[model samples]
Target: MLVVAGAMAETSLVAFRGWPSEALEFYEGLTADNSKTYWTAHLTVYETQVREPMTELLAALEPEFGPGKIFRPYRDVRFSKDKSPYKTHLGAWLEAGGYIQLSADGLAAGSGMYQMASDQLDRYRRAVADDRAGRELTTVIEAIEQARIHVQGHGSLKTVPRGYPKDHPRLDLLRHKGLVTWQEWAPAAWLGTAAARNRIVDFLRTSRPLRRWLDENVGPSTVQR
Candidate 1:
C-alpha cells in the first residue's frame, strides 16, 4: 500500500512488505512457458506482487544507499537461439555498486565489477601489484570470506598474465578480468518475510570495503563496450 501525506503533488511512499509466493510461482510458470501469452496473462501478478515489492525495497534502501534501478524483464534475443521472451530473474542495482536479484533459487546479492574494459583491467592489475593496495584488498576479502561471502574473478586466465611475476604473492588477484564478492540463498520461508530485506541490507553493508577498494583503485571504465 502507498501512503500519501502532503497534497502538493501525488508523492507517496510504499513500505516493503516482502514478496509473496505468487511472485515465485509466476517465475516458475514463466520458465516453463516463456511465451508472450504467459507473460500477458500474469502481467498483473508481476506488477503488484513482484515489481512493486522490488520498488518498495529499493525505495527503503535509497536514504543511505542512494537510488536503485530495476532491470527490464524482457530479454534480448537478437544473438541467441533460445529466444526466451523474458528473463528468469528480477535484478536491481543499488547506486553503491551493489546488486540484488530474485529468482526461483531465492535472493542473490553482489558487489564490485562483473567485467572490466581493457584500460580498467590494466589499472586493476596494477593496483593488485602494489604491495600496500594488494595486501589491503586481500585483508578485506579475507574478512568477507570469514563472514561466508565468496570473492571471485569473472574470467581468469589459465596462467598469470604476462609482465606480472608468475609466482607473485598476489598472483591470483592479478589474473582476474573482473573482481566481485557474491552470495546466494536458496529458496526458504524467510524469503517471504522482512528478514529478506535485512539480509540484503547486511550483505550490502558488509561488502562496502570491497566496493570502496574497487572504486578507489579500478574506478570506472573509460573505454566503451
Candidate 2:
C-alpha cells in the first residue's frame, strides 16, 4: 500500500516536472512488484476506496481547465547551486486557479490530494497586484479563503497540531517566501474530505482560465524572461 501510494505521490511530482509517461511507468512498476504482495493489496484498497472517485471529480473538472500540460523534468539550474536531476511527480495545471500534486503515498494517506499553500496563494495575489497577470489575485484569494472557511465550517474536526518549535525550517521558509504570514491563521488545518476535494477541483478549474486571460491582458512579465 505504501509503495503504491508512494508511487502515486511520485507521479504527481513527476507530472509537476512534466514527465507523465515516466510517472505512469513508475506507478506501474510499483504495482507490479510481486515481492510486495501486501502492498499491492493495500494499493487496491486505496484505489477502489479513494483514487477512483477523485479521478472522477477531476475528470468532471476537465472542460473548465482544458488539457493539463506536464512540465519538463530538467531543472533550469543556470542560476541555482542546488540542482537536482529531476522532479518525481506529476502536476496538473489548473486553468483558473492553483495546481494539484498527485502522489501514491499522498493519495493513500489522503494528504496528496490538493495543496495550495497560503504563501503560494499569496504569491499569486501579489502577481495580480503587480500587473504580472490579467486576473486579479484578490479575486482568487477571496474565493480560496471562502472555500477554506466553508470547508472548516462544514467539514472535518481536525485542528492544527501544536508543539513544533518556533524555529522550524518549514515555517521559517514559508515566512521568508511570503507564502504565509505569521498570524492566527498561520497554520490552519485544511479539511480533507471528498467534498472539500471537489471544491478544490472546482476552484482550480476557474483558476486555469487565468493563463489565457493573462496572456491577452498582461502578457508575460519581465520576470518570465
lDDT of 2 by residue, 80-123 (tens): 88454333333444443345544432321111113233443344
Best by lDDT: 1
- Best TM-score goes to which candidate? 1
The residue-level lDDT of candidate 2 at 203 comes to 46
Q: Could you give candidate 1's per-residue lDDT for residues 111-225 as a string of tens digits?
A: 9999999999999999999999999999999999999999999899989999998999998899999999899998888888778889999988888999999999989888876
User: lDDT per model, in order?
Assistant: 0.90, 0.37
- Window of ten residues with lowest summed lDDT in model 2: 180-189
Give TM per candidate.
0.93, 0.33
